[model samples]
Target: MLSYARQTLKRVPSFQELLQGTMGSAKEEISVDVLVIGAGPTGLGAAKRLNQIDGPSWLIVDSNETPGGLASTDVTPEGFLYDVGGHVIFSHYKYFDDCIDEALPNEDDWYTHQRISYVRCKELWVPYPFQNNISMLPKEDQSRCVDSMIDAFVEARISATKPKDFDEWIVRNMGVGVADLFMRPYNYKVWAVPTTKWEQMQCAWLGERVAAPDVKKVITNVIHNKTAGGWGPNATFRFPARDGTGGIWIAVAKTLPKSNTRFGEHGAVTKIDADAHRATLKDGTVVKYQKMVNTMAVDSLVQHMGDKELVDLSKGLFYSSTHVIGVGIRGERPERIGDKCWLYFPEDNCPFYRATIFSNYSPYNQPQKDVKLPTQQLANGSKPSSSEAKEGPYWSIMVEVSESSMKPVDGKSLLADCIQGLVNTDMIKPTDEIVSTYHRRFDHGYPTPTLEREGVLKQLLPALQAKDIWSRGRFGSWRYEVGNQDHSFMLGVEAADNIVNGAVELTLNYPDFVNGRQNTERRLVEGAQVFAKSKKSVD
Candidate 1:
């Protein structure tokens, strides 16, 4: 054996090289008419619209190797798939639907399922939109909920101050009984905000979020012991048949020209020279654009821009972090969880606010029947008697737990706590063998519509626009009222249109108008017609 080793020295560039433009193949001063940051739904929407217009030089960049921000999916080493949380496709805009269909056109690309959601409370499963389904609750709960709703409804006719806060909104509409039983604890778990803080939370952010029960209809349903079937916009929704939700974005990205997109480490925005209308990438390449459509979190964009005044103003905005935990079990789907798409946990039994029957959404969500895997541990953390690998059918559950400075979580024990939560909530048995697990935390998960939200956005959005920056997306725009996938996508599409032809960004500025009706201003099929006409004109 030779005692000599070959020495290979690889030069790593310093931070100064990256800052001063000494790395990579990107040009020093590349310019575009429109520059989009982040390749998530919002960014893709902007790019799709820009490509459709065929009038501007545009480029879309993202730090992620693949698209989809919070909407992305992750697969464990054992082949179990999980999304960021529980994401269901329920479109409010025809343009949004057209864009999704254009991406995954085939009938086989999706799996449609009726919404079968429930709220777990007092060890009973109540139909979702809890207020409307109070009939399913225990006798005492039903009486309390109904009485309070009637009182609140009558008070609404005489009262004049709208609502002071979310707490007051719930009490004024849902009544005190429902608030104490479900709304209070459930929302606390989801938003990581205390019930008392609801008084400090604005009510406008709740547009279309909650459905107040019709007192007469609710009384009729309760009298008959009948269950409410379809209630929310997501009553009937679809999931991608493959690659999880990330598959949808990947398919969408495939439609855009690759030359106009940049991703991975090289595409991350390190700094933005708003004064110079330039953005610096992680690789030291600077992108100069006439107008930038920033899809990153507004706070994150502010941090990268290094703007002191904007940073201070952004302090008024508050957001909660999300912890997504996934558990893949090595067995067939259990009878208790049969066909239940998603379940809400309002009791103290579970650390998670919500749990989705992920495997039931699609067969591709779990591994094949033949894949072999050893049980890592039981849901309760007991050691497996046998260390050998086993195989056959499998099932999975995805859970979402919120965290913030107000609500701190022990990260080291989160997975274990989640497993225990599953057992406590009857989602999994103590002896259930867990094959795979996943835990991911997103910093800017839910943009809280705090009392100061309106005040901040009033000044913040216009300030960014003065610098030719359109900061729009879930976190970018900071509007939880219109923060769904469809709404986020349209925010980008509308932002692009606004930049190009002075079009109104209805989705951004007037969320109530967009959420309340079907927006059909543009169609994907019409886009093809326009494209053909434009090509003919050019020829």
Candidate 2:
């Protein structure tokens, strides 16, 4: 055993040798024109743009060994794939669409799934765009909702002032009945903010997030007992066929020159010296940069820089944590759950605000029907009849539970509580076999679009720029309105453009314009055209 141990030990460098190697690298000054601090969609976006320009020396680093950050996927030992949350490929920018297509060009690389979403309330599945499908609701609820919406329509004719907050916006467009029944409760669950705190959020972010019901159409639907169909950008979306959502990012990362990426512990940023224009990595390597595009949380970035005022200023930005739970069951895809993309849990039967039929998104998301796996336990927490391995057909569900100061989550029993909640909501049979389970909590999940968010960003972003640091991303910018995967990616791309030339960041400065309209300014097909024309010469 000692001889064998010596043989294994011989392959590894001595601590002294490792220390010296680290010291040697630390002493070497790695300089770049642009330094990207994260390799998520945002950082990758920045990196992609820089690579396309081919004029700047750039390095993109991420703490994780993988390329995707919050948008990454995880695989369970029992052969189940789950994403960070319910993420669908719904693009506002043609640039984003083109970039992803360039990475995974094959049509076979993705599975197109129609978004069949619904709200579970009072033991009934109400079709999504809840206000439009009031016919699906109980008669009492339908009557109340229609009556309140009629009152709101009448009230709006005389009221000239804008809504003071999101709560008021809901009351204005959706009416008090819908607000009380669905909007308010679901918002509280998903945002993890209390109804009272809804006033802290603004309505400007409400561009297309909510589908304002046409009162007449809704009334007609209720009268005719008909329902509504899908709405918004994600009405029909795409998911990668293999390796889950993370595969798309991994493919995109491969497009960039590998020499430019620094991932894993070696890439972890330990400290940032804004004055010196250098960043220290966890491996002790120091990077000197002309300008930095930071994709980390702004509050955390301030703490890393040890800037007291900036840290305090960043406090005004609100965000919620997300607990993602995945359940892999040893059974066939049930008829009842067929073709459902994701389901909402507005009622108290489930702890999760939203549950995605993950396996429905793609066949590759779960193990093949032939793969054998032993049951972990039953959904009811009862012992299985046998511990023997079983085969044929499996399915999975990915649920998201939000947590914030206003709403605390019990992390210890989260998985168990979630499974029970699933049973309560009839998502699974009490006797169903659970093969595998996964639970991970992301500290910075949804960036809250608070009333103070825009106010804080107005000051914080420009201040960081004064020091040659463009802090942008979901958390970096702290604008939930423009914090989707596409928006975040474009944020980085725009930031890179702003750094390279004096280009105006349309996505960053004018989110409403970008979100309201299709941004086709930068296209992959036009790359050759874009290449011939210098960005510096454009202005």
Candidate 3:
């Protein structure tokens, strides 16, 4: 009986194909054990796990044909590739590491890089974790940061209270010098929220994430005119040897059952009837499922469901959009720009908060060293006389800008502004020939850890779960700390486990707990000997 049901279900037209059927042939319902929405890493993660278990009739659908979500990559007309931002592979989980390894198995499949990072201040490149490297700052700036650090240290030793806002937290830990110079301005640019509006709880993630300077060491280094070495967890990471970050997801998607996945315009979900366990696709087919995993932004999901209560609660969650801009140039890689992965921009010289030397990740990131293309214009907006399609080599850079109502951008001129900013920051030569460009706006980019965010998610998630719908993912849960690819993927994995078996999802509920330790035990198949078997089967 079960086998017959499974076979019949497979033959039934999908919600999408129903549109092509005759008027009377259009089905009123279709059924599956589980329906996963959004083909991003998180949704794919859920689908991947479901496939591994080989349990329950499951199907995954996404609006876009491609995968990767924000971690995806884009290519320029000139053949340059740029990721959404700077997506480096640095995982805290063996499971995630193993999964990526499985996707791109060969040594040539990856590029291991030592992070060459920097901060721009007063036209000088300072080592990151600006608070810890105050010795490199100008004498006056150093004095200010050092004095503030001492005061903060003394105050913390005696004071019985904790800081309340992000600004106070910065001053308490980094001192006024670092705060005034780097912390305050830089964070505002990146977060699109004033430090005053940010809560101190957000600082909990910054310890290992940000490098703190030792005053004595910094002073000594400054006196000796010495620069600090690389700091932070991602001082080294892996990148795909080919394609951009998106290649990893695309490859991972290939490992899944093709029949279980749906994409393109037909995949767009118009409405979801939670009570009926039904989802209406763009083509007017209804899909009924026993369980649903939604990866769309929670706020958007609420709107799609037309649930008044969920929508109201979701309003408490807030996020800022991201603008990714890529530029490919005609020339050899610059000498001054040697081996830098990404750089931070805090000053007003540029609207972008960060810039990655996209070409530095791989040679294929740009057009073949020999591909010829006419120059659109120089970096400075000047038309070049060189109609010559001459290029033996090329390099590219990608930049990210945060936009919100609070921090509005001139969209019409944002690309031009970013190019000018690149020149101002010496990232590009004014007369450098520009070969290609790419720009895209993602509406629900970064979920802000606003003071109100936690309160809302606390209520919203449980409410959805009570209705048998699991809203999980980057914007789905709206927790920035757990919103990375690994975290988001695990959220789905754990969510599925919780629904299938009564398992406690440590990563989803307690991010700090999962993040605090090296999670080595979360693999689908364990043991070194089993790796070969697992690899062969997964491949």
Candidate 4:
């Protein structure tokens, strides 16, 4: 690569002439057909598809030492694993499944989970699809909810026009009582923005992701004192049996040739010179490419390029930072927890919006029962009576706290607050020994689907694409509805298709179209016409 750079420099001596009076060492340069930034699932997907086609010379890179970007997991000193937030494998595409299956082919590599989940409401656990399970609420609350739901049904029968914003949609579909009691507070806690205020979120991003209550069925359930069945894409999901969520991407990255990937300090991209189609890494290696697939947050990418117009447009995009807090308890798994996978907290009683039993996902997620560990502190913040290490069958819980301008958190006290909240909600006993605690803050967490997002993306994306850059991923596309692991991965796949063969970027442009049905166009098999090798016609 260094020799190539020297030869290129010799061929074009303008760089040498300009640096005649300056002290500088020649930087190594490498070339590829596609330069992929960020070795997350999205970047991996692009590289995987490119490799499958055998047409593009591509290199995937990330600043992190590991491959999983936001979807990655971290481990505590005590051996507990925590994902960035709640994450489970629920696919909307066959290609995504094929790639994941390729990565972890063994049945033992994963544990399929039946979604044992609930919402904490009025100091009671309500089966989720909280709107469908209002039967569990106190009688008075149920009465109000049913009355408003009946009103919403009547309104739905008469109303023709669509809801303008997420707030209105919530009220129109779930009724004012459901909105006020659960939807409003839960969304606020998750998005860190009010659904009805100036920062009101848009509703188009929701493509059947949120369940609309079946009014008559819900009423019947209420009358019969029953709970609704599980709903949505994640009703039954899977998790890695060994590492946490991050393990999947790491395994996927291994499928790609190591020579094609750069990670850690070497992969940290410092600048992107779009005019020259070059990306400069932190190690001073310049990677020149015919096309680029950028998986970093689009807002950050625009600022890195120093494009004033794009930066100005990117400012309209909103996001919330996530603080993931984990607590490892030194005890047997409590019966109250049962097989519960994740639980949601909507009220102010907890700083976290949701909590997952990380230990429940897999036995390896926490240390083995024989692994002894000393208590860091009690759940109630008091010193443990015994500081000596102890052995136990242990369980762990991971909680997520959202922070933004509208909903700021006390960073220093957030972990403590979350632990105390567990006790308050009976998630953990006050005297439970916390053997491990982990806290991490990710700045670009949940991308907000604000009213202004479309206008900014319409302009910003095209401007970048004109320079042969395709920014697509969770934060890259900034559409939370299509921002899961599956969606993000397919975004890269579609971007590659557009770059190589000019296929329509369905995941990027037609989110609702893609989300409305199962997309089985491209499979890792013969006769999958959508993914066949094609001539490079986009240029």
Each prediction's number of clashing residue pairs:
0, 1, 3, 0
For model 1, name the residue pairs that clash: none
Models sorted by lDDT, best on top: 1, 2, 4, 3
Which candidate, 2 or 3, has the higher TM-score?
A: 2
**lDDT tens digits, residue span 338-357, model 2:** 88889988777778999999
lDDT of 2: 0.85
Any residue pairs clashing in model 2, and if so which? 369-393
TM-scores for all candidates? 0.91, 0.92, 0.91, 0.92
Model 2 ranges with Cα > 4 A deviation: 1-26, 517-539
Against the hidden true structure, what lDDT does model 3 obtain?
A: 0.79
Per-residue alpha-carbon lDDT of candidate 3 for residues 1-539, written as tens digits (9 for 90 to 100): 01214444443344445555533344356677778998888888888877776446788888887988878888876788989877888775677777778888899999999888888888888877566666778888877877888887787778788776567777877778788898888888888886556662355445345565666677677678677777655777888989899999998888887767777776789999998889988867678887889999989998999999889888877788899999988888889899888999989999999999988998878888768788989988988897778765888889999998778888889999999999999988899989888999888778887666667878999899877888899887787878778878877877777767655676677665555533233343333235456558999
Deviation from native of the Cα of residue 180 in model 2, angstroms: 0.9
Alpha-carbon local distance difference test for all models:
0.86, 0.85, 0.79, 0.85
Q: Write the per-residue lDDT of candidate 1 for residues 251-332, one digit (tens) a residue.
A: 8999988768888987888899999999998877788788999999998899888999999999999999999999999888
Model 4 Cα shift for residue 283 (angstroms): 1.0
lDDT of 4 by residue, 263-323 (tens): 8887899998888888998868788887899999998898778778888889899999999
Better of 3 and 4 by lDDT: 4
